[model samples]
Target chain A: MARAIPTRRRWLLSLLAWAVGLIIFFPILWTVLTSFKTEGEAIAAPPHILFFHWTLENYAEVQQRSNYIEHVTNSVVIALGSTLLALLIGVPAAWAAAFAPTRRTKDLLMWMLSTKMMPPVGVLVPIYLLFRDWGLLDTLTGLTVLMMLVNLPIVVWMLYTYFREIPADILEAARMDGARLFNEIVHVLAPMAAPGIASTMLLNIILAWNEAFWTLNLTAAKAAPLSAFIASYSSPEGLFWAKLSAASTMAIAPILILGWFSQRQLVRGLTFGAVK
Target chain B: MATLHTRSLARLMMAPSVAMLFLWMAVPLGMTLYFSFIRYNLLIPGPRSFVGFSNYYYFVTDPAFVAALVNTLVIIGGTLLITVIGGILLALLLDQPIFGQGIVRLLVISPFFVLPTVAALVWKNMMMNPVYGVFAQIARSLGLAPLDWFASVPLLSITLIVAWQWLPFATLILLTALQSLSEEQREAAEMDGARRFSIFFYIILPHLARAITVVILIETIFLLTVFAEILVTTNGGPGVATTNIAFLVYAQALLQFDVAGASAGGIIAVILANIVAVFLMRMIGRNLEA
Candidate 1:
């Protein structure tokens, strides 16, 4: 129970909090606002705060000049594809670890997590070379597989944590009722695990959507996701501020919306359940 | 409670993930090790001969390597300092009773969801550009000169962008931990006439110690490999100014096609990260029992 502060002090604190929050959020807000401005307005000497000659020309031109739909499609496919694949492989592993008591289960879980700590650069050369040799470069399937591999540990860890919370008695009760092994999982486990699985899926998709290192190194124009699409603006020729803003807004808006819903899950997932 | 049939089934279920991860970790890492030992260049497609320690020697002795090592440390250390401190303050503020606290948190965490490329490009052109950037506009309004952020302070600028992206993560985690701190303890301290600073220093800070350690360790892992922000913002430099070890290896492998040299650099990065990983794993491992 927090002490009731004086009303004046509470009001002052509220003002301070709102000011800090708005200032921290200003960059993203500015980008979103700039996305609606004209090229000249975007780079205006005195930047337009609110009142501007607003236009959707940048969004229209961004789509026309660069196939925005294709990049969007690529991002969707890669993010969802990798997340689903990770779930497919991660669920059973987590279920086993959560339900079964083995001396090595803890060790195995730690090892899986330690794999994530290996810097991607350590294996960049081989992965790049292998992708090149196997013609996996600039391929959606390749990127999906790579993303799945990188995020698999988190998926398993999150599911394991969630599954651990569920009582073994439920499964035991099901088994006592003559339910077969497959029937036990299908009937009792899946329904109970749906919420956990969904959050895991959401977080992984967000991670894959924003993954830049592999996407940048492996893909060219053909299979480039939004990360690559936005990065295309890095060079000066692609430096139309309004168009860049439009593209950036498009790239981030979906994930940002998704991310809001998964904020709780994100803390649990990223911290490997250490904080929680 | 466990039957033999179920135990075997558990192992079977775990096989795919275990085997896949094993292959994933072993294959590429083994290849990187092998590549590092040989004189391999992508441009020179001939019989590759064993160069043993020469690749390591050259990669280490290169001037760029030293600069990259220093830049990597600076970026990691700088970003960690900013985010952790900023996060603690923000978390404390948010913990107070405030109007529209939910919306405030939503706004604070928004940047963490922005794609790295998008964040970098947004900062590079819209905020940091000398002529027409927001900073320039602010500077001109104050009758001061606009600073060329990338050219003048490439690494620091990148550090700021990365720190902005990560500050929310630290805040969210710290706030979560703060909420769990026992209220009775605080009330007791307050009743004992401890002022805010005394309570904070003796009680709140100590309670937040584990959370802070977790934040530092986790952030260090991600911060060590900050690539896209640097790649998009500076391309590793006005002149190798922002090139961390990750970018250094990338430039060697992709730009120069020096596979052997790049592999050696990759090994060095792995070693450096492993040192940090060892400590982090121990910290997390201890938490498991609790």
Candidate 2:
């Protein structure tokens, strides 16, 4: 018996879902809207809900006043750089953990995960001191290394999950055919897991690009990413709504586009290895 | 010889990453533990002395520590409540027949990819500005008084916004679980004359138990350490009402340059997080085992 929800109940549920979704997404929508208003109109009394002159002046000011390109470049370089570094390190490590498990492999994986559980601030002072002493403070290399290390655990974990999904028999077949270990992984494993790897890289790059703590703490000017670019607008000298929104929209636009396009891959990848 | 060579090669491939992560985890943490036991402050640079547990003593006794800890707990608890409930409800709804579901899902997931600083700035400036925000606009249109979200009564509105950014994660995970559920079992319940509510409560909810646990554990780990949002929006402000331990430690170390005190506070936070993490990991491990 196929029992169907009544029309009224279905309508109610749909309306409720739409309302909740809108409420959750309102902030992002409001930000984009405010970016077009004048500074005065952006923070007008009773709030300009709809009636306001839309202008690109705020974006022009944000671009003219701030070194938007430098931060954008820094964000791109660091996010891509750290993600690639994490992958370079994570791939082999995950390969070993997934395929060549020893008595201590699980323990090792757990320990690696526990490191992520530790509060980042617990080590911030030491890292800050270390960075300052090593003269890596405010350097792209410094942020790259730090972000890479922080994001490595997730990379390894995700890759391990993906690797576990590949049948061990295929690798055995390659070995039986006299393929070298490197050739086996390169040919058999890498291609099979490419989708997972690509998604992992995308996710990690997003995480790194969005990271704010180390970027704010370690880098002041030269290595500041889009995160820091947004933070600068948060001056104690009162808020600049239009310009702040403009900067924020600029900062998130690229990742937002990426996310919109790759939503399927992102969702599938994250849930794929976990449920099974 | 080839087998041995392959194993050794595997070990060799793993060594650099292992060693780097090993040092990355140990060196700073080792420094934190050492610093916690010593008398050290950046402003008062001198020969440091080992002060067994006084730093911890002072840190635990400080009201700032208490405030920060409580705030951390409240935010974590508040976020967990909102995300879990909201996520489950949203997932259930999205699982229903819907128009433009993919686009909705993408919009819903978009916030999670947003940079924390940008999200916070967007919320603080464009949405929660109290005066010129959409919330105020709606309130005025509805003939109700507008409320200042960051002020007296609803300081946590910003925290909720930050938590909202993460809600999609919980929804996606849970929704995946929901979709993977055995349809035959649902039909069995239907045949058994189980009411819709009973079917959901008895069958669907239990099927989602594992997903819920995963969501709770992953979200808790991140929520306990939420920093960027607080830093950008509140700065632990409006009278330290929003200060979590991370921000507190940051202020102590960077703003005051009190390395010893900050280290002590940091250790305390680590201990607390570890307690929750242990339970969470155990649950996940057990779930995986099952």
Candidate 3:
């Protein structure tokens, strides 16, 4: 433990931190606040810091004009679906790299990571053509597969880091107890690695939810996610501040709530492999 | 026999994922390379003849290509510069024993988790509007004219907004790194009559070198392809001033339907990305080795 700082200095530092943090967070807060205002109040001169009349008209319009429920359903299906799919494939790969090391494991991991480094646009033309030709355009299956591959490397990386932390002696004991390979993984590894896997799944869902590029380009109307729904609010005919805020709030509310609850897990998972 | 069987089974279990990802990465990239070598514009339909390096030659020679490359570097470099320096300051500030630290941390990190589209919309509409924007309000209060950020210094403003969203990411990572530093090391330096600045320079900074690298690496990976933020804010304009390579590629491919040109640009972008990736891989590789 370190020595305690003086009370005055501590108070000053804490206040400064809070101020900076809040300022950075102000835009999102403003968006949420603006969602409740009428369109006139939203763009009022001097920026209406809580003096305006509140209304749910924007939300009503958003729900009515845009099939909000369908988009929400699409977001849930795609985000969770892709995360589940990624984990299904990533777990075995991570398990092998963690417990059954080979000379090629490091190279394999690096190669997978390198694929992530490749700009998504570098292959956009080909992918667009492939999807178009395959008749997979504007389909959840198309976006689902894209998100899975994009998130696969990250899922595997996190799982590998977590799996490495498990003691080999424990697994060796399981084997010595005459547990079969399938049974050992199912009975031992899965339970032990549940927290890590859960965090991985959560992080993947967030990533897939926020992914805008492919969703915007690949799906127009049929399979567009909430990201696309928010983007639709953007128009050349002046800023629709209230309606756009409403749409944004609806789009991000679920994941933002999830993030708020799981902040610690997310922070832990993000920093897990970075330190050691 | 069981041990051998288990090892083989584990290897086989991993094969499907490895194989699929390989195909997923290679097929599109390989086709991009092929398209880059031929006259394959989407508009012109015919037996595409092999035009060795012609598309690449045209892409390089074009003024827009040069401008796009410069803009890409500007955006990435500018954002990195602000985020790295600002993030370190914020991280250090937040690392202090702060009251309401959890709430502060959440607030700082909230931007990173916001969907890019939403972030862009909020910044463009709420914060930067010359008429009703918060920035304009403050400017008017100071008796100054409202500056239309999108019209004047459009690229710079977009870069600032994007940097704001990403700064929290850098700050959080660095804060975690800072928190892990040994307090005894700082106390020992203070005991030796080292100034706060000197202690930070000598003891704290060295510990943060790896974190900074990670922040830079991850930030660069996304910054190179910053599409939605640019698209929503400026749409690469006041006359192609803010158009980055990614947006350029999108325009070429989808908007203009110049597949040959987009393919060439895509190849160029991939090469540029790989250069940064190599540096990041080496750093991560060293860390993994240690």
Each model's lDDT comes to: 0.92, 0.81, 0.86
Candidate 1: which docking quality band?
high
- Misplaced by over 4 Å in model 3 are A261-272
Write model 3 residue lDDT over A166-253, tens digit each, in one string.
9977888998999877787789999999988988998889989999889888988889999887887667566578888888988887
- Name every residue pair that clashes in candidate 2: none
Clashing pairs in 3: none
Chain A TM-score of each model, in the order shown? 0.97, 0.91, 0.94
TM-score of 3: 0.97
DockQ list for all candidates: 0.85, 0.56, 0.69
Give per-residue CA lDDT, model 2, range B15-67, as digits (tens): 87778888998989899999999999988979899999999898889887888
lDDT of 3 at B47: 82
* Comparison by TM-score, 2 against 3, better one: 3
The prediction achieving the highest DockQ against the true structure is 1
Error of 1 at B75 (Å): 0.4
Residues B1-290, candidate 3, lDDT per residue (tens digit)? 23576678778877977898899989989999999998887788888889999999988898888899999999999999999999999988887888998899889888878999899878877898888998998899999999998888888888988898789778878887898898888888899999999988989999999889888877898899999888777778877899999999999999989898899999999998998888888877776666
Classify candidate 3 by CAPRI docking class: medium
For model 1 the interface RMSD, in Å, equals: 0.9
Model 2 regions lying over 4 Å from their true place: A1-15, A44-53, A236-239, A261-276, B287-290
